[model samples]
Target: MDPLLAKIEYWILDCVENEYSYLWEIRSVIEQRLVDVDKAKLDEYLCMGLSSVLTQGYVQAFAGIDFRGEEQLVPGFSISTSFIEQHKKAWQAGVEVDQDIRFLISDTGFEHYRQGCPPEYFS
Candidate 1:
């Protein structure tokens, strides 16, 4: 992995993990994908896909640390319940972000594999 990409991925995961306690798996997937990101690809994704808020948060988290991007990487976290609620509300509002988040659930209902969230916790 390019050093710049690795650093960026770590900052992303670190920020996201603060908000979404159950996203270690997702972070791992992102890290793997980042290994292929060169400077040009990183810039392209930033311009198109990723929000600048993420980078800002990372910079804030590590104040005084020099990062690759000109934008400050202020660390940020999403409120877990609020994060879930935003998706729920978006789905309800007929947003195409995805099918109703509620519909994504299986009958079991979020069996907790993580220590922070116990089984059937969302309800």
Candidate 2:
């Protein structure tokens, strides 16, 4: 693979790790602040966090790639639309699943992100 692609992959892995760590922190906060935090609340937070990653991590990261003349960092010089679509589907599916299960799956997804292919890989 191209060195730039490798860098982008590494960046994505780091971003995903940070995102999961953030989620764990949020879960801890909820557990402490509220005796019983609703599943909906957790899911809502997860959605927001993932949205931030998509917008800030992917989109904003793309800007830096362009500035640095590493357009290949993202395929087609942009965040692949198909990757975004898959992510949207995954997010929707997560929201539709049971809350406890969703949290579990999300945690697993974080690990998968760190070690496995990014959504763009599938795209």
Candidate 3:
């Protein structure tokens, strides 16, 4: 496997181990296709797809990062140094930017932010 793909696979596996359903969706979509993603395509998917995932509150479970309102900078995490660097490259490549990832939980058949979220997440 190409190194990029190997890293991506490792990261995706980490995502699944963390029980992040949204990220799992990303992996599932690619895996189902059974194809390799070049750097450009990967970057595009991360920027656009990740944004959508974040907007849908999938990032909360997977990212361990907190986002508040639109003004806030969503938090970022690192599963691996190489993976993180690859992610930045994808962003620099101008992947389609859309929704921001935020935190929300579904309960009682409703979607809401997780309770007791710190007023200042960065603190």
* Predictions in order: lDDT: 0.33, 0.38, 0.39
Which is better, 1 or 3, measured by TM-score?
A: 3
**lDDT-better candidate, 1 vs 3:** 3
What would the per-residue lDDT of candidate 1 be over residues 1-123, giving only the tens digit for each residue? 344444443444333443232222333344455676564444343322223323333212222222223223223522243444464465458665421111111112222112223223222
Q: Could you arrange the candidates by TM-score from highest to lowest?
A: 3, 2, 1
Please identify model 3 stretches exceeding 4 Å from their true place: 1-34, 61-123
**Going through the candidates in order, what is the number of backbone clashes in each?**
13, 0, 1
* Model 3, TM vs. native: 0.30
Off by over 4 Å in 1: 21-123
lDDT-sorted candidate list, best first: 3, 2, 1
Residues 46-120 of candidate 2 have per-residue lDDT tens digits of 344434434433322222212334322222222333534454465657653221111112344455455665545
Please identify which of the two predictions, 2 or 3, would achieve the higher TM-score against the true structure.
Answer: 3
| Residue 98 CA displacement from its true place in model 2, Å | 20
Q: Which of the numbered candidates is closest to the native, going by highest TM-score?
A: 3
**Candidate number of the best lDDT:** 3
